[model samples]
Target: MFEAVLVANRGEIAVRIIRTLRALGVRSVLAASVPDRRSLAARLADEVVLLEGRTAADTYLDVEAVVAAAKATGCEAVHPGYGLLSERPDFAAACAGAGLTFVGPSPETLTLLGDKVAARDLAIANDVPVAPGAEGTTDAELAEAARDIGFPLMLKARGGGGGLGMRVVANPEDLAAAIEAARRQTAAAFGDDRLFVERYVENAHHVEVQVLADAHGNAVHLGERDCSVQRRHQKLVEETPSPVVDPSLRDQLTSAALRLMRAAGYENAGTVEFLVGEPEEGRRPFYFLEVNPRLQVEHPVTEAVTRLDLVALQLAVAAGQPLPFAQDDVRFEGHAIEFRLNAEDPWRDFLPAAGRLTALAAPGARLDTGYEAGDAVPSEYDSLVAKLVVHGPRRRETLPRAAGLLEAASLDGLRTNLPLHRAVVADPAFAAGEATVQWLERDLPALLD
Candidate 1:
């Protein structure tokens, strides 16, 4: 075990990492921006190194500052708790150069899986099914590719995934504008302007397999998660043992995920996301989406079902330790659901809000959050303020408890999407596990009205 580790992120993830470090007896040194000096993560950390800048660009996203803090704090490793610089190859390389272990995949793997286009090609080479797609460095190339892929194709940035630089083009007339917009967004968000076009499945489920590997070549798939309940391509609710996926489909998803992970020589915790279509002829068609090469925001739900500490696993792998368990040893005990509570107003088109959280009341269930009462919800970063995770013996038994928890929970001083989450859990389609990626957007008007 490491004597000390630097937590190089913020919000609920930062706090989550700190808890694991405490349990493992690893001293935690937090790298916080000026605005986060008084954050709950800072209070929980054994030590704090304040990054001078207030904005993400100069602080959390700055590779040099984070590395320097880890070195200065005498940390033996760094754990980037999702987002920010978590998937940045340069950041991982910098940590290696500084003789500090990065508690994630190697830089080489990050470089390979971080680019959407490259990952798609790798999947094809590994014989893993992927949506028909073509890559382009310019609008002309993408425009030509779109003509073959046809209308209703998705335009996505080659670098970074999280629905940031993505657009759905309904027809040729909208291609150029969508291309320009996607390019600009991708360039600003990921420092890459390259784009790709692929066939868009009108009705699909967003299912992802959680896989963990070690440097010693041992790997296993934890299971699949259904993140179909979404809005604007962003996931709002995630659950394990996707209510719609049967045993056969689950085997295919996990097998494909393990094959890709082994082929890429991936290590540590990573997620393989896919777009799954409805069943036809007794089989569901699933296509590769993208790989997230770091810990994900929805990890807690997986933990609830598997009874595993992913953060501990990441640390063990970074220390060059072999996986303590094998494929057969892993078990999925129950169904778990996680609802992302963002500081946004559902009535106003889900506009992000910021203010002091004057009141907060979560009576039961697991609530992972960085802000407490009297804490300010800043507008400069991600809108997510907390995650409410509920677990039950089965999906049917889980929905009511999750709904009740949301009902009892309260947050004041800023608008929240709580009402929207309430509506989702109570909706028949969602409760029946029939919600797709487009369900929320398609039915939002009726649910809200």
Candidate 2:
């Protein structure tokens, strides 16, 4: 096991990683921005390094500063909780150059999977079905390619996530402007201006597969999650054992996900996302979306159903250990759901909300968070303040538990997406197991009205 690990991110994920590291007897080192001095993770970790800035660029994303801190603190490795430098191939390569272990996939795998277009081609080669559109993210020949792919398309940023650099073009007149906007956002967010055009599907469902691999050339899928309930391309609610997915579809998704991971020589925890279409020719179909190269924000739901500690698995894999269990040894016995409690007002177009979190008490099966009452909710980062995860033998048993959890929830000082989550749990369409990508976009948008 690594003797010491540095957490290179902020908010709930950092805290979550520290907890697991502490249990494994690994010293946890936290790096905080000027305003993050009082963050929960900083307080909870064994040691804290105060960086000299408020902006992420000034601190967390500053590679030299982070590596210097790691050296100064004598941390042996870095565990990028989820975002920030999690998928940055350069950072991983730098860590290797510095003789510091990066607790994730190799740099080659990150470079291979981090590029969306290239990954799509890799997917097709591995027999994974992909949406018809876009040559890839680095397709510098976009206008020519866009002209070929046709309008009513999707303009996506090469280095984008959480839907930052994505735009839908319904007409030829909108393509150029949409592409420019996506390029700008992608550049600002990812430092890469690569863009691509792809065929856009209307009203699709978002499903994801969680896969884990080890150094022994073995990988296994932990089943599927339906994260179709989203706002602005960001997922709001995630559930395991999608009610609408049949056993066959689940197997196909699982098989393809494992293939992609093995082909990329991926290790540890990663998510393979897909877009499932609504029944068009009387048969519902799914297409590859993208792969998140880190632990997902909703991984607890998977843990609840599978009874596995993914963070621990990551640690084991990073240390070059084989998986303790085989593919068939994994079991999925129940349905699980997780709701992201963000400090955002859903009715106001889901704008980011920030302020002191005066009070917070999660009400689901289990609550995971990095903030408590009196913690400041900053506007700079992701608004997710807490996660409410619940589990049961089936969806029917789980639905009521979800409703009660929401009703019992209480948060103050910061506007949250709680009410929106409440509405979704009570929504008849959602309750009847008929949620699709179009469900939120077209069917009354079950958010807080």
C-alpha lDDT of residue 309 in model 1: 96
Residue by residue across 99-217, what tens digits does model 1's lDDT show? 99999988999999988888888899887899888987678989999998888999998888789878999989999999889888988877888889999987899999999999888
Model 1: worst 10 consecutive residues (lDDT sum): 358-367
lDDT of each: 0.92, 0.85
lDDT of 1 at 383: 91
Show the lowest summed lDDT stretch of 10 residues, model 2: 134-143
TM-score against native, each model? 0.98, 0.95
* Candidate 2 per-residue C-alpha lDDT over 303-406 given as tens digits, one digit per residue, 9 for 90 to 100: 99999989989988888889999988998888999999988876777788999988888644688888888899887777889999989999999999899988
For model 2, what is the C-alpha lDDT against the true structure? 0.85
Measure candidate 1: CA RMSD: 1.0
Q: Which stretches of candidate 2 lie over 4 Å from their true place?
A: 136-144, 147-151, 280-283, 443-447
